[model samples]
Target: MSVKENCQKIEERILKACQRSGRKREEVVLLAASKTQPVEKILQAYYCGIRYFGENRVQEGIEKIEALKDYKDIHWHLIGGLQTNKVKYAVKYFEMIHSIDREELVDEIEKRASKMNKIQEGLIEVNFGEESKYGVKEENLKKLFEYILTKEHIKILGLMAIPPYFENPEDVRPFFRKLRQLKEDLEKDFNVKLPHLSMGMSHDFEVAIEEGATIVRIGTALFGERI
Candidate 1:
């Protein structure tokens, strides 16, 4: 199917998921994970009414952002594991970073954003103690939040996670539930409101939305498999 057709189908699914979950369609943001896809494909999604796009790499995202600079309403997101060296470019280009899991990263972002004279928005990536995944452990999340609360240039909007894959999407529900619960706990503990839960992807986005995902990062289901 074409990108437009894929977008239509995904939109329908998002609407139905919202209905099933008794949530408003406007509440969920459909972020096109335009990692390796070319600008043409992103434009196709843009024409289909998608305004949010996520890139996994800082350099690639910078190129795409430059190429698509004329599209003023587009919101770019960095959704991969960000390195300290790349913090400057990532802060300058992307509107939000979705993989903040350490103090070093927070410090770098705060410094860069402060130099650029802008507040950088980000999400705290929570790893379920998976050695392979990149995120702060659940036990260490409070500590991370405490440190981030002292920073001036970067703001934590919510949480993001790449949960363990399950053939059946139902099995992933618990992980999503855990992320949401963590967000709730953080809000109460810090007396702050973290509004965005950047979880779920092509395979289990509907499940993510049902569990209070304000931002769903979808790629293959929208842009087809990467080449």
Candidate 2:
């Protein structure tokens, strides 16, 4: 199927998931994970109504962002692990950063945003599923949150996570549920409403949406498997 057709199918599935969970389709955001995808194909998805795109690498993402500069209203997101050295470019190129996992990275982001006079928005990535992953552990979230609040230039929009891969998407449901509950708990503790839950990928996005994911990251499902 073409990118447009793929997008239509994904949208239908997302709507179905939202309906099953008693949620409105508008409450959910579809972010096309465009890492390693060509500019032409990305444009195809763009024309098909995908305004939000995510990339994994800083350099590659910046390149695409530069190439697509003429495409107004395209919101670029950094969804993979970000390095401290790339914080400046990330703040300059992308509108949102989704992989903030540590205090040091947050500091870097704050410094760069301060220099640019821009308010940087990001999601706190929770590393609950794997030991070797790149997110802040669930237990340490509050400490991180508190520290982040002091950084006037950076705003923690919500939480994001990449659960362990399971052949059956059902197995990933627990991870999504936990992230949602964590969000609820954190909101109550901090008295702040997190508007975005950046979880789920192409394989298990429907389940993620069913469990309260406001933004679902989809790549292969929209752009086909990466070469």
Q: Each model's TM-score, in the order given? A: 0.99, 0.98
Worst 10 residues of 1 by lDDT: 125-134
- For model 2, residues 23-89, the per-residue Cα lDDT tens digits are 9999999999998999999999999989999999999999999999999899999998999998999
Candidate 1 per-residue lDDT, tens place, 97-200, comes to: 99999999999999999999999999999999789989999999999999999999988999999999999999999999999999999999889999999999
Model 1, CA-based lDDT: 0.96
The backbone clash count of each candidate, in order, is 0, 0
Looking at model 1, residue 165 earns an lDDT score of 94
Compared with the true structure, model 1 gives a TM-score of: 0.99
Winning candidate number (lDDT): 1
How does candidate 2 score on lDDT? Answer: 0.94
Q: Clashes in model 2: which pairs?
A: none
Tell me, by TM-score, which candidate is best: 1
Model 1 residue runs over 4 Å out of place are none
* Model 1: lDDT of residue 164: 95
